[model samples]
Target: MRFNRSSCDKCLDVCPVKAIWIDDQGLHIDRDACTGCMLCNSICPADGLSIQNFNFQSVLAKLKDLQSPVLSCHVVADNQAHIKIPCLGLLSETHLAVMSILAEAPVQLNLTACKKCVNGVVVNKLQKSLFAVAAKLMNGSAPKIKLIEEKADLHFRPISYTRRGFFDALRHMDFPETIGYSGGLPAGDKPKAYADKAVPDKIKMLNKILPMLPETLKNWVYENYYYHLRVDSNCDLCLSCVMICPTGALKIGGDGSTGKIVFSSAFCNGCNLCAEFCSKNSIDIIKGFSGKNPSAYASCEAAT
Candidate 1:
């Protein structure tokens, strides 16, 4: 968000309801008109937007036990979906990719209620993101997402397991515990400086799920979802990059040294603020995964 070299209009372009605007005070949202579609959050490379009701972690936890997963929007009543999201647009590429990776079969997505829903505009965004996820997560092979649109005003019936089968399947599955993702300060506590600018919870959750993926798929996750840094000798450990980094992706951390700058691909968020603000012009980013720990991978040592 602090990157001022060039302005970004990605959020404005994707807001289906036109609830976002900008002025001298910075970005503003018309909460009254905002439909909470979350297309802006999904599209923002820098994560400049925030939404309190977007809860995909709980949805993902429920899908983990099911061999085959079907997701639908909440507008669809009596749906056979394994779980329902507020809207399909709430899912960014990262969420969809993670879901597909965990499921054994193609992830069935029911968009049958879009046409009749007020938030139906997100359907276009959903289609684009799903295709992108398929290319990266499945290597452009058979589509990972099987979208079920309305057929002659009639929705396709997905195979819904009996409640007994649901509980029984849960028992046989050797699954780990659910992703109990909860964060925030205690009751009335307030955030200190730059706390909100730190690494996002979603990125943390993605790394938490990494170990569960197969070896081959893990490698793909590194190459696609993550990124690395390339620093030249111009860096003098001035600590500018680390301080300016909104996501805490760049930090003066090492195995056991003071003059080392660590880079975490998972927390980078593709903001490029570190490189843009670097006075020495020493830092460069190598996009795509670096085949290392996305959470904590050392790139170059700072000049002592």
Candidate 2:
């Protein structure tokens, strides 16, 4: 959504089939042409793309049953020992880091078929980069999450649901249509602009995993994994950055006479919207992680 800020075109560039594109209206994906390869979903820094049926929590749930877990794409031959994902590229650094900490043994990522697949080249590179980052964030002592090219021995079993089961599921559904209301405004309330409430799931995952990492690794991630913004004295409080921030990471507040800008590093995905939009060039993006201080580098005074 902040595509205008950093001019990010990662999703468009990575589409193996050229299913993604951009225009004045914003990003667009041709669902009919999308192969569900998920390369775009994995590489988007802002978590802009998502797979409809892939529940990350469910994948984590499955990990509880295994001693040594191997993750591979469904395109790869499945083995009973390995947990298959729709695409190997779906796993982000946060996903890998969490799995590494939760597993009893080293995590194996199968990428043997990636080299030959249309989506494999970019995904293979991404897998390696994310693995390296996850490993570094865990310190040297962290379990080795290796990328293996060897084929696995696996099987697949399909489950079928009965008519009665389907009926039972329908019986429990809370249908929104059941709310007896016609299309009319409330008695006193007025319509307002829609506010985006969706926070990137990756951010939530990162927050949970950060505390479990080794102190040294945690420090490194905080210093390097996130982007920090610094507001210099050149800022005239135009508030352009605040309005453009997709994640609500930048905020402006105060009375008409005085105002201040505040930032929360935890919410920033380093899209560089503020820095890029600043007409005065007062905002600078600092690469790496900042500590718990939300106001660090982002606090600035302005006259309204």
Candidate 3:
């Protein structure tokens, strides 16, 4: 996965197993535990993570030469001698569910070992989430999906840490304290609320009167610093964006009227998270009103 340091952790969210992690040295992939499943590229919000792409026809021809049968799967395996596909974030829960029904052989996913990957967060997410979804569909039974990390005796090449750090800083100029991937919440059945609704007057008047509301709610109403974008015209009003926003900023609300995407910048950290993964390309990242210069946070925010 190619990740800008600002929010490279996108890979950490998809792993079926908790094989991906970050530290002062940066992201690491535990090759021994990774299940080469390319799920990380599928779910990454940045569309940065990817696996080596193997042409399906070529792979099929090679399998024929080996006298082995083709493997039918909804997921792809990560290997070095493969084509370049963006991170495993491309896959979804439905893809995993379908794999459970189509394949019969014990499935194996070959992924990067710790030493071989610069983008460990992306690889790790692919492993964990695949396992979680597989377990649910298989009723706790072993999934056809299996994890395997690749081993390559390669040497570390030196590069300028200063240059890397500089560019990373630029991308994260407006980011929050902690951005990228969600975890620690257990599954539940609570009914979720999407974009917050408001009466027609509330809709038209909120932006104009934002400075007049209570401090606590003022930012909430105007989405002060948080960046928001319109759902594409194709948006089925899926409300998925409402559900996935970590800050509880976007919500579905309206008056017998067409529902709208409401946002609260009070809780936003100026993370370009919502815009990164938007399938519709309707969102854009812009500066939020933090009442201070953006450089202040850029200088002070902790590095991941």
Candidate 4:
């Protein structure tokens, strides 16, 4: 699913790789080591995920529709389509692996148009690495991989009317204007926050594993560690949280999996979209940094 405040980041929370994070733009994903279980997509609340160019059935049809270099196609669904982003750079390798297996098609990630991807060249390299691993994992039954480059107009409607308007959007988003053209904050030689705290064994283990993860999952882990949420026992299995979550992070499984909602941090963006939609007043959106943001926190944390 497309990562955004409109979606949930449950997948981001559970990912061992800490591949997910929320930025001013939206959810960013790192593709390496994603494993493609698609548990994240299934758990997403918004159903915001749609395979980039084709639906499930169409992907299945590709197995029979193959011709020349066209083996199987990997279609990505990324929410960051607004800027100059590449198609292949949209999802992590785990997402692609899920597509390769479940869709029964060799993945053909399209990156031909990413010459100036807003996400950058690093994303392109990640796509290549993940594809290789995915191909190897496919065994002898692997599908063909193809890179199709093409450009489609990004339908970014101007949030403002003029140059001042551009600054206005930044101001509204609370973004620093003087920072480098690279979308990050201004660089300084100051020490980082909370870097020298006493480390628990569990936290130490997490730190050791952090660098090995895909970017998307990594960010998710960091964000959840910084901003967390919870579900209370008062939940009524209403599926309200599931329906409202944009990224499918809140899942209501069949066979009473819905009896208790499963909150996957990997898929949550901490946007509080689910908290706003709950009927029984059973969900809470807490800040990972402070444990709860009073402006967005709810009393009872519910699930399923």
Best by TM-score: 1
Tens-place lDDT digits, model 3, residues 28-103: 6776666555555455432233332222223222223221122222233333322222233334443343343334
Model 2, 1-304: lDDT tens per residue?
A: 4344367888888777888888876677776676667777877866667654346655665554455666666554433334566676677665666666556666666666777765566555655665576557655454456676655532223334599966774464333212221221112223222234244667666666666677776677676556666787788888888877767778776667877787777778777767878899888777675456432435643322
Tell me the lDDT of model 4 at 26: 56
Q: Can you give the lDDT of residue 66 in candidate 1?
A: 58
- What are the lDDT scores of the predictions, listed in order? 0.68, 0.63, 0.41, 0.42
Model 1 misplaced regions, further than 4 Å: 1-6, 75-80, 151-192, 195-197, 254-258, 301-304
| Model 4 TM-score, 2 decimals | 0.28
Leading candidate by lDDT: 1
- True-structure RMSD for candidate 3: 21.1
Candidate 1 whole-model C-alpha lDDT, 0 to 1: 0.68
If candidate 1 were superposed on the true structure by all CA atoms, what would the RMSD be?
Answer: 6.0
lDDT: the better of candidates 1 and 2: 1
Q: After superposition on all CA atoms, what RMSD does each candidate show versus the true structure?
A: 6.0, 8.4, 21.1, 18.3
Angstrom error at residue 17, model 3: 20
lDDT string, candidate 1, 26-129, tens digits = 56677777776778877776656654445567667766655667777655556556666556776787877777776665677777777877778878877787
Ranking by TM-score: 1, 2, 3, 4
- What candidate 2 gets wrong by more than 4 Å, as runs, is 1-6, 76-82, 112-117, 138-143, 152-194, 253-257, 293-304
